[model samples]
Target: MNWIDELTSTLGDSIHCDEACLLAHAGDKWFASHLPDAVLLASTTEQISEAMRIASKYNVPVTARGAGVGYVGGCVPSRGGLVISLAPMTRIIELNPADGIARVEAGCLTADIQDAAAELGWFYPPDPASRKESSIGGNIATNAGGPRCLKYGVTRNYVLGLTVVLADGRIVRCGGRTHKNKQGFDLVGLFCGSEGMLGIITEATLRIIPTPPARAAIQAFFPDFALAAKAVQDILQAGHLPAAMEITDAFTLEAARKHLGADAMPAGMQGHIIVEIDGQERAIKEELPSIMSILQSCGSINAMSATEPEDIERIWQLRREFSASLRATGLTKLNEDIVIPRSALVELVDFCSQLQQTHDIPIACFGHSGDGNIHSNIMIPLDAKGNERRAEAEALVHELFAWVLARGGSITGEHGIGIAKAPWFEGAIGSNAFELHQQIKSALDPLGILNPDKMGL
Candidate 1:
């Protein structure tokens, strides 16, 4: 049978093959879009296994998808292959409240799981910025993180076990519902950020934590980023662990100020750091002063403003709205998720300023500072020169990654290095690690069909 007939015979009309529908499954956040041969809606692990087996037999690349909200083009089907969407598989298989662990389908939304667990007085802490729309599978595949990752850690740390379907359609379970496991190898971790190069994730068992009794938000404004940088170091040095820590500079603040309006934040401030501390009220009262003192000592032009509960919501709304506001700028934003040591943040930010000055580009900078992960978005212009400037943006994007690596940082802090950064894999991980990755891929799929063209075997 032909591709469509063969796929339809197995998956029924649930397969979406229209060119317009296939276009929807093409690409994600950063990579350019392409037409997929077809999109299949999978509802169970059995169905996922069936799809993978057939796709592998046909030698068609299968791009496993969650919500397709990934920033690094991990979910995008760069090759015109099968887009195996897992959205319908979102089911909370088990909520082990007594054990503080839960088993969920890979298609479940990450934030929805958090909300569901929170309602039961539990928490799932590896929150991605796109938690609202991002799926648990995408988070696990990318090992996603957010501001809260400062203390709770990222996705890989929380995933106790996973039910994965190998590239050859064999089901291999790894890890278990336990805190400690010195198994043969840390294959669990190896697959966590594999970006679909290794296997197709069907379900995952996640570790959870007890929700804190109280949570408080702190907002510190800095006249300059340097002072803001110092305040971050001071707060961490003070030995107080915060649930979340984030930084926003002038360009981003301007975007916030304009998109969210003057009331979102003080119009004149050049930088802002929003931190959330949770624990006993007594500890917060004591640490709150120290946090304020650090910001002030770092050089606060005025008494730092207090965020009313309403204002707290307003500020958070502003921060969360940043990605959307950026899209309104009329240019495709090349988001670079780079991580550096806390000490190197100032240098990275400063270098970005130099980069913009030298290349004459506009970039919005912000990130989960407590974790030292920053998103430096280079905005391509909308004028007639947009294409030419776009070339410069693309070139510097890799250059920026190289600079981050030179300073002992990662090309992607939270976002996975999927097809978007696949070209630079050799520069980032070197031949040894890249070879190890290929070896793992070969072991998983000898035919090399799963996400074949995107992540590079």
Candidate 2:
């Protein structure tokens, strides 16, 4: 029987090979598209396991996809085979505050889990910018990190257990709901950032922490980017660990002003820093002054503080709107999430400015400044025909990656090395590490059917 007939007989209407379904599962937020031979809307782990078994039997590539909100083309089925979408399996099996864990289907939205935990006075701290739309499965696949990760850690920290479906349709459960687990092997960590090449995640048991009693935020504006970068180091050196510390350069600040109006930006601000803190109300109140004083000493032009939750949210709202604001400028935003040594933050921004001048293309620099993960976006201007200046942008990206690698930095911080960064994967990890990765991939996915052509594995 044909592959379509077999899938249909096994999954009924859950299997779709129509043009619309194929196109829908083709790509994600990235600028790459390829139609899959068929799309499997899996609603349960059994369906996924069966689909995988069938795909393996047919030697068809099977790419497991979540919400399709990934910035990298991680979910794009580059090979024309089967796309197994887990989005239909959105179920929160349990939220146990007593145990400080939430058992949920892989397709559960990251924001939904945070809201559920918050209702119980608990916190799920991985707040990726796409949390509202990104799925737990996708976050696990990429081991996503957000601003809060500087203090609370990334998605891998919260993942206590996982239910995974192997490429050959075997089911495996690793770890448990307990906070501490020293099992035979750390399979949970192994699969968290495997990029869906090893196995398909079906469900996850995530650790949650008690929510801090109070929260506050401070927004500081600097006359230049150097002072802002200095202020970041100063804040850390002052024995203060903010829940989240973010910075934005002048290019991004100007774009925010143009897109969000003059009022959206602080007056005479060339660089902006946001520092957030959470804990006891009195402690937060006491800490604000010290933070403010440090900012002032760093030559901050002006500083604003938000004590109330609503006020803090308003400040963060501006930070969250940055990516969208850049898009509003009618230029394609090629977001490159690179990481450098904390001491190199200023140098990185300076390098970005130089690249911007050299290429004559707008580059917006912003992101988790406290941790050295900056989203240095190359804003490519389109011609009258509405096509990107691809050649210039590509050349700039190569240079940027080369510079980052030379300085002991990573090509990607949060976004995984999808097809977009595959060319540099081997070089970035070195030959020994790259070969180890290949061996692991071959061992887990012998047929090489899972997420083919991704990460160059």
Candidate 3:
């Protein structure tokens, strides 16, 4: 029998070789897509280990998938072999507040874990925009971050332990429920941002903190992005660390005004900033006014502060609509989540503005301003045939990445270096580091059957 039949015979009904299954598991939110020979809807760790063993035996490439919501092509089954999907393994095995830990299956939705923790008076703070649809395992794989990561830290910080399935089908448990573990090499961290190339994560032990009793938000409008960027620095320099600080460019504001109507925000508002703080009710009340004053001092034309939950959510709703508003412009949006030093926020926006002017491209910048991880989107107009002018956009992406590297900024802060950034991965990490990556990959996946052709490996 062929590999597909063999997978079916061994894995039973969990193995699917139909066109629909193959197509569905082929890609994610990225622009690229390719069909795998077979897809395995994995429901348990054992199933994944057994499938990996079979793939190793057949010398077939294996790609692990989660909820398929990644912006990069991190989970794309580029090589036609087997795609093991962990979406069926959605289970929170334990939520132990006593130990301040939550043990979750690989396919568990991030939002579900957050909601579950909230009910128990705990908080899991990795708030990726796609939390409702993205899987915890995928987040761990990408070492994902968001606006909240400015103060709370990224997914890697919350990961205390992991259950990983090796390329040869060995199930190894790294770290434990303990908040601190220094037994050996940071094996858990080795796989955290490995992008599924090192091993497949079957389960995770995450650290959660107590839920803050009170939270408040402030929305400020600026005449230009430089002042908004300055407000970010001024807020931090003023000895305040917000849970999240998001900034938006004038282009995105105009798009929002056009798409959501003219009343969405103040007219001709060139820059927008949203600051969030959480703590005791008394503390939040005390901090809001001071932060609001700093905003005003930094040239905020208009500012609004909210302490009520509904009011804060309304403010965030506009922040979350940024990408969709850009999409509504009938242009192909190529978003790059780049990171620069906090001190370079103004310089980065200035660089983006110059690029926009030189290339005749509309660039919309927004994201976690406090952390300097800005989403600079390059908008490409469609041709007469309605096809995306992707070639020009991609050329501009090359130029933008070059500029970022020259400025000592990262090409990606949250999204992993999948096919989209593979060409520059080696250079970005340096020659010595690139060699080490290969050594590690060879050590773990000697046969090279797991998630091949990713990260330019």
Candidate 4:
């Protein structure tokens, strides 16, 4: 029988081979696109197991898809096979406050879970910028980290258990609901950031924390980038660990002003740093003043504080618009989330300035400066000199990656090694480590049917 017939017979209407479905499952937020042969909209673990069984029997590649909101093209089905979508499986199974755990299907939206937990006076702290649209499964796949990760940690820190489906259609459970589990091995960690090369995640049990009483934020504007970077160090050195800390460069500030109007950003600000503190009301009240004073001491031109939740969100709203502002400048933003030591923050910004000047490209820098994971964007006008500009941009990215690796930095911070960064995977991990990764991939997916072209595996 044909592959479609096999899938259809096994999964029945759960399988969709239509053009629209194929096109929909083809790509993600990234630029690349490639249509899969069929799309399987499985709503249950059994359906996914059956679909995988058929695909394995025919040796057809099966790429698992989440919300398709990933920035690194991690969910793009590079091979023309079946795209197994978990979006239809979204369900919040349980939210036990006493147990401090939430059991949910892989397709559940991150923001939805956060909201659910909030309703019960609990907090799920991994707040990626794409949380509103990104799926929990997608978050786990990339082991996503957000601005708050500097304090609360990433997605892996909260994942207590996972139900995974293997390449050959076998089902397995790793970890458990308990807070601590020292079972056979750390399989949960292995699959969390495996980038779908090992197996497909069906469901997850995540750990949640009690909600803090109050929160406040300060937006500090600096005369230059160096002082802004210094403020970050000063804040940490003063024994203050804010929930989130962010930094933005002059290019991004100007872009925000142009795109969001003159009042969108503070006047004449060359550098900006946002620090947020959350906890008891009295403690936050005591902390905000000290942080503001540190900012002023570090050559801050202006400092603003937000105490109310609405006011804090308003400040963050402006920060979140940085990406859109860059796009409004009519340039293709090649966002690279490279990370370095905290000491290298100022040097990285200086090097970016030099790189932009050398290549005559408009580069915008911003992101979680507290943890050294900055989103360095190289904006290229694709409409003008498309081919030549594209080539130059590629060369610039290579240079940036090499410079970062040489300085004990990583090419990617939160975004996984999807097809976009696969070219640098082996070099980033080294030959010995790459071979070990390959061995694990072979052991889990012998047919190489799961996300075959990703992570250079």
- Per-residue lDDT, model 1, residue 427, is 76
Residue-level lDDT of model 3, residues 328-376, one tens digit each, is 8988888899988888888888888888887777789998999889999
Q: What do the candidate models score in CA lDDT, each in turn? A: 0.81, 0.92, 0.91, 0.91
Question: Against the true structure, what is every candidate's RMSD?
Answer: 2.2, 1.2, 1.1, 1.2
TM-score of candidate 3 versus the correct structure, residues matched by position = 0.98
**Model 3 lDDT, residue 353, Cα:** 84
- In Å, residue 139's CA in model 1 sits off its true spot by 0.8
lDDT of 4: 0.91
**Model 4 bad stretches (over 4 Å):** 382-388
Better of 1 and 3 by lDDT: 3
For candidate 1, lDDT tens digit of each residue in 244-276? 888888887777667777866677777788878
- Reference-based lDDT, residue 416, model 3: 88
- In candidate 3, how many Å is residue 289 off? 0.9
Candidate 2 structure quality by residue, lDDT tens digits, 1-457:
9777899999999999999989999999999989999999999999999998899999999898999988889988998899999898889999999999999999999999999999999999998999999999999999999999989999999999999999999999999999999989899999998999999999999999999999999998899888999999988998989999999988888888888888776756778999999988999989999999999999997688999889999999989788778988888889999999888988888898898899898889999998899999999997678888988998999999999999999999899998989999999989999999999999999999999999998
lDDT of 2 at 77: 92
Write the residue-wise lDDT of candidate 4 on 193-246 in tens digits.
998889899999999999998999899788889999999999999999999999
User: How many clashing residue pairs appear in each of the predictions shown?
Assistant: 0, 0, 0, 0
